[model samples]
Target: MTEFRVLIVDDDFHVARVHSTYVDAIPGFTALSPVGTAALALQAVHALRPDLVLLDLYLPDTPGLELLRSLDLDTIMLTAAADPESVRAALRRGALGYLIKPFAADGLETVLRGYARYRRLLETPGTLDQAGLDRARRALLGAREPNALGRTRSGTETAVLETLASGGLLSAAEVAALVGVSRATAQRYLAALADEGSVEIQLRYGATGRPEHRYGLRD
Candidate 1:
């Protein structure tokens, strides 16, 4: 089996790092690159043509939707907002995975595992037969529900906020541990609250390394 190549495309450096970590740790995953800008992401895709592209719906230089127009690889659409319209748009555009920002890392992993299987099926004769397609649809739908540990995330967004309130600020990884979900999942809720002006993100520069991001409730 070939080492699966991946490209992480997101504006948030911290979020990209977390995703990069997950990809690097996966068993069959090969090298994964983090590209913060859409222009560079396109260039990387054209050159490497990774097995997967984790894409954000919004980018600084270009709309993510436009970037979607070009890529032919299996894409995991990353969205900051969980709006139904945005999700529907990704599906219509053939996104293999639709991840709401701060989606649980485990959840993303599970989906990727499924995608790996689905990719295998692509090599099988007549795998896309209507029956197979229906089964795949059902499987994807099943992934939409919360797992045992992730049940809390299905609760009100305010509930997620309460956990983050314990201290002044927290990284998505720290918040995910507190809530018992993947860091990615923790980020979605945090980003949403931040967008609503309920929370503020502070970039903490360290003594010797890259800066870390922490989120706190806005007073």
Candidate 2:
């Protein structure tokens, strides 16, 4: 299993470091030198020969979308720019994934993992059958559906997410009560959300018994 070399491109030194650290912690990825300007990014991409790039839309020298249009490497957009026009332009210009800034490391991890799966599928040997082709397509273009849960999108999942997004810690029981679902069902949804890095989890210790699990949206 070869590690994917990634270059971090962003104007803020601190944010670039944070992204680099996240990439470093993942098992099959490595972060190359972080660059703040689009010119430096292009230079580093040529010199370092990284396999992937995490690009920010707002750059000091050039627009990130302009850079994306120029580069042939696999790219993922990681920017605080959440405008619809920017997102549409990035996708139209061939960004493989987009992670809005102010996102948790878990969120980035999930995206990277999905990207890895997509790469693996494409690198598979020989002719691809319909199933294989479909799997690869889902891996690359199915982020909103067939989610990490392996279940169809549902109102229940949305409700659970909204309840947690209200900004407080909750147990499965509490989530169930609020979402009007059974405890088992709530636990299933919460566990799936945690797996996708959409939420964070912690063990809360009680006075005399075993610790209980608590879930909350990542801060």
Candidate 3:
């Protein structure tokens, strides 16, 4: 599977690291080194060519909205700016999503997964019919049907559970390969299951880099 690259643009080093960790934790997505200024962001975009950018509204060098207008790449505003005008300006400038700061990991994950689905839907071959077009639009809008905390499961979700039952501990990518779904899709389901206490996550430390997350049925 082709990895989706993400660039995190926040002036705060701590916040940027947190966002980068969240992006890396999700399957099928990788985070590039974050930039702290609009100028650096511009240079990074030109050099790295990331698939999506998590942007902040305020920067020391330039306003993020100004930077947004300058960027042709896909972006989602991740900032503390909650003013209606800022929100409207961001939407008007073609930001894919806007996330208020101090948000939980799940909130960012939801948007990232939705964006992934949106891209997949629209990037497919052939012209889209009305229904297909609507689906793509909804995905872009991050419209998700409420699932009642593992009370009910889709066929794919059940397959993921069964795969874990047999395979012992496995990473999201491994589960995806076993269940015949995208890594992002598998990670979404696994996250939901983990949230409901149906599954447990183990962090495996390596000699270098971040720890790997492996999931299994909770005993």
Candidate 4:
């Protein structure tokens, strides 16, 4: 499979490093060195020509939305700006997806995978029929929407959810130990809940090694 090159544009060095690690961890995706300013981002885009950009709204030189207008490449807004106007402007300027900051560890991964699928669907040679077109559209749009995990919940899933609701962030291993399930099983449940917007995933970065992924109930 061809790797999808991603460019991350965030002013904060630590945040950019975290996002770069996240992008590289996903299969078939690789991140270029992140840029802190819109000017540097523009230069990187012109030079590297990445397949996608993870853009932040606040930049040192230029506003990310304005920068989006200037770039022809695909972009997803990753920002701390949660204002309605900012969201509306980003969508209007053709942002592929909008992810609020402090999102789960899997958040960018979800969007990146969706974009990869979307690109694959539309990039195939030949004219697309209505169904094909719809699938491609859904591949792009569905990633931004909350998944329909349905109202019914399994006993294990309910236990996982309840456990998260009761307290602070918990790792899958911790949840598994508490709920009497395998770590993989716990992860599956937590991921499903996160997709449904019922749970939040937080990454705790340390001085060394990979960041720890912790789960909590969304307020």
How high is each candidate's TM-score?
0.60, 0.65, 0.70, 0.65
Which pairs of residues have clashing backbones in candidate 2? none
> Per-residue lDDT for 72-149 in model 3, tens only?
989999999999999999999989899998899888977876787677667767998987677667767766434533
lDDT of 1 by residue, 161-217 (tens): 888778677888888888788888888777555433355566666898666768887
Candidate 2 residue 76 Cα shift, in angstroms, is 0.3
**Prediction RMSDs, each to the true structure:** 13.8, 10.3, 6.5, 9.1
Model 2, 29-96: lDDT tens digits are: 88998999999998998899999999999998899999999889999999999999999999999999
Model 1: residues with Cα > 4 Å off, grouped in runs: 125-128, 136-219
How does each model score on lDDT? 0.71, 0.83, 0.85, 0.84
Instruction: List the lowest-lDDT window of 10 residues for candidate 4.
Output: 142-151
In candidate 2, which residue ranges exceed 4 Å CA deviation? Answer: 141-219
Better by lDDT, candidate 4 or 3: 3
What's the lDDT of the predicted structure labeled candidate 1?
A: 0.71
lDDT of 4 by residue, 93-178 (tens): 99989999998778877777667667766776899999767766766764432233355778998899888878999999999999
Estimate the lDDT of model 4: 0.84
Top model by TM-score, which number? 3
TM-score of 4: 0.65
C-alpha RMSD between model 2 and the true structure = 10.3
TM-score of structure candidate 2: 0.65
Candidates in descending lDDT order: 3, 4, 2, 1
Candidate 4, backbone clash total: 0
